[model samples]
Target: MDLILRCLIFSLLHQSLYSKPYNIDGLLENGTGAIESLAKPLQDISTKDYSWAKGNQTCSQLLKDCKEFLDLLPSSSSWMLKPVLALGFLQVGCLTEQEPFFLDLIKDKNARTLFNIMAEQTNNSIHPTTTNSHKSQPDIQKHDLLRFNLESLSIDAQSISHHMHCSEIQQEQQDVLLKGSILRSHSSLQHAMDHCDRVGPVCAGVTSDTLGQFKSVARNGGYIIPHVGSKLWLHHCTAGLLRRRSTDPECHSEKELRIHNVMQWIPVVSGYYNAGSAIYYATQGCTAQAEDRAIDASIDLGYDALFTATGGVSGAVSAGVGMAVKPPLRDGVKSAINYFKAQWSG
Candidate 1:
């Protein structure tokens, strides 16, 4: 009996030593279960009909449901669990009618804890720690982790879209879909902007400024881009010009330089033209292109005015020359120009 016991102990130790370290399946199952539990309260809040007469009562019920749902969230810090937590936050935020109540609930200690968890998880996911331990791991493990995170994000995003009834939710879903595609293609920031442009003005309106900041940072070698609003306009114009050059061969040829010179000589000339045309169309009850032209004119006028104040004719000419060049230094040069423009605007 002593000999049998000794043999059994040896077998158990060997098995333990060779076992797999990570439990991918277990984590996925736990995530799914947590999502299901959290989803129930959100669904109830979304589908119920509340009359204005019962507004206060409805608000109270909404807060109760949100608080309970938040309380049910698991406290695990595993990166795998972030997706469901993100989904819960998104669902609660989409409750536009209960905004006031929802705002109040976030003040609770428990609600703040969950929000901090999500924010910390997001930061860690974006800039993962690279310690000695992480360095020792195989590349395959890192790849698998990334793939798992993206898969989980996609799944939870779909779930949020299906259950939430808001335009903002739909926009978030579209952003997730675009991000996945952008990752697969391994394209530059400019390419991502192009994708947004192709998705139509709604997508562009939503993502343009953010993408512009990203592009500016990338072009500046990871430095923060300056100017809150002016850089945004310059980036928008640069992206528009880049897109135009890509789609229209004429914009790339030597002939385009002449047109660029014309615009350079008469600062804000195109701004005046576009603004006049916008006013004409607006008076005639035409809306489609009128609004777009008006926006363009505003950007042009702003760009010219800001640059003229800071660097005068030289600045305006330099900016025009920068945009007229080919794609090599387009983003970097434009960013530099905007930096000066931003300094003056401030």
Candidate 2:
């Protein structure tokens, strides 16, 4: 990797390594939205921003499935969806180029190193068949890393299904072990799972737990969230996305190819909207700063959407970022204000 890409990867990984997962299921308003119809599609495909919470689920059914989705996801398929979005989000290149992208990453061993770090985080105990956590293995390839993460995710998901709640102490031990695993040394975690602890206090006396805590639990249990290195992937893919098809420029139409390639990113955009809105709801009643942060989250998410739709770094940046971010940012601010006001009055 060149210095720019290396620095970008390290910066993103370090900044985002310990960030929280956003639980979209918890963002509903009294079971509103058509969640069931949406849920079926989201199972195989990622979602879009405008339709983030626009589910056809009635309040009653939304209450049922949203709760269930949050309670315990037995399948790792849901957990793996977010990473799929990440891959899609970073697809500045054609889909066919993905093999070489992974290949190039393997050449430098970064792919192996990154996955090994996740493998270190891999833990199991839910299903008898899924005990393997991908740890302590030798001579792993880049492709194996994500597959191992998926397996590990399956184990964690099954544990949730079985009600194997990992106490903070045990989670802490895992964190310490992961810390000492010699991955990246220089450090300060700006946000930890613990940092959001106070988010639960917002519901003191009225609710059993803070919205943030519940959402975080749902996130951890279900495994639906983004992680580091997507931006680098985005950067890498940008060239292919902007350039005409080299495979068979004459035979295969560029428009069709581009459409196929960009579709991968659309669902990820929905993922961002869903997750960001969840956080907005989670932190809305906490504080003004928290509320402001939620708005910021949506704006950040908008950038991801712009990347896929617009194509190329310059195109994404030059186009109206304000226009891109405005809708969600506005909605977030409105919701935050409305939520805290209702809480105080109640």
Candidate 3:
């Protein structure tokens, strides 16, 4: 009798997993879930007209507000805050690393299913709709932009990090590095979640603690990028790291130069993109491309300065060779680029 009852209960539970359809109650928890805070983009994210809704909020500001909201909430209702708190770590880490905060939205089981649903709605062949159809639209274009600003960052960045993400690498040492990278990503996310579960909806006093955690995560994530250059990290390790500042001015001033370059390029590149897009009445975003171009331009301009400083020894030959070589090199880098591009954008 006991065995039969147990078997019956197990059978019913198994069936329920497949039989139950996606329900709002599962994700929203009858308005108790805080996934809304993370996902609340302007209405019609598929279109371009939506203004400042909750989803369009910057991750830094959104996090500050989320923390405040959690602080004010009642203890009994704290479960609702689980989504943001767990997501906050991923958001901050990814954000500082300059990756997308939006990807953090679907990390929760409920939100993951919600994301799948949102993604499915935009499907054309299966659930095709007219241009004005709201039913087919996803509600987060910021999600789209940030979604494009993936952890790999660019084709160059992807090339460096590919070993860490690739399943096909057979070398034991690289496999270790890959494991470390994966572990950092998962561990950081998990640690935040567990901490939040213990702390509750309101992590009233941990502002410094949370920021520190994010900064550390954003800094390296333990992937072993030599000299902190995402481009050269994989391809040139020993010589790049060990080379004297005298011999290689590129490694010497690379960090400061890159930051300076990016700062200078952001406005110019973005303005260029905005102007062209406006002229064409194009709605598809140019921000991501503008950013990549800005980085590339910055590197070029920085090298021009560097070569001038080095009296054209490092400047002309290196820059000239770079100008000659970059197109082909970038074309070669496209394999890793395409993989992540397809994986994220698909």
Residue 192 shift from truth in candidate 1, angstroms: 14
lDDT by residue (tens digit), candidate 2, 50-86:
2212223233443233334323322212222223222
Candidate with maximal TM-score: 2
Residues forming the 10-long window of minimal summed lDDT in candidate 1: 217-226
Tens digits of per-residue lDDT, candidate 3, 1-346, equal: 6456545643442222111111233333334444553355412212211111123335465455544544543322222123223332332231221234444433444434323332222221121112432311111211121212222222233233223321111111111111012212223434533443343312111111222331112112222211111110111111112112212432222332222222222211221222221111111122243223322332222221111111111111111221111111222223334443463355
Q: Lowest summed lDDT over 10 consecutive residues: which window, candidate 2?
A: 231-240
lDDT of each: 0.27, 0.25, 0.25
- Ranked by TM-score, the better of candidates 2 and 3 is 2
> TM-score per candidate, in order?
0.16, 0.19, 0.17
So what's the TM-score on candidate 2? 0.19
TM-score, model 3 to reference: 0.17
Ranked candidates (TM-score, high to low): 2, 3, 1
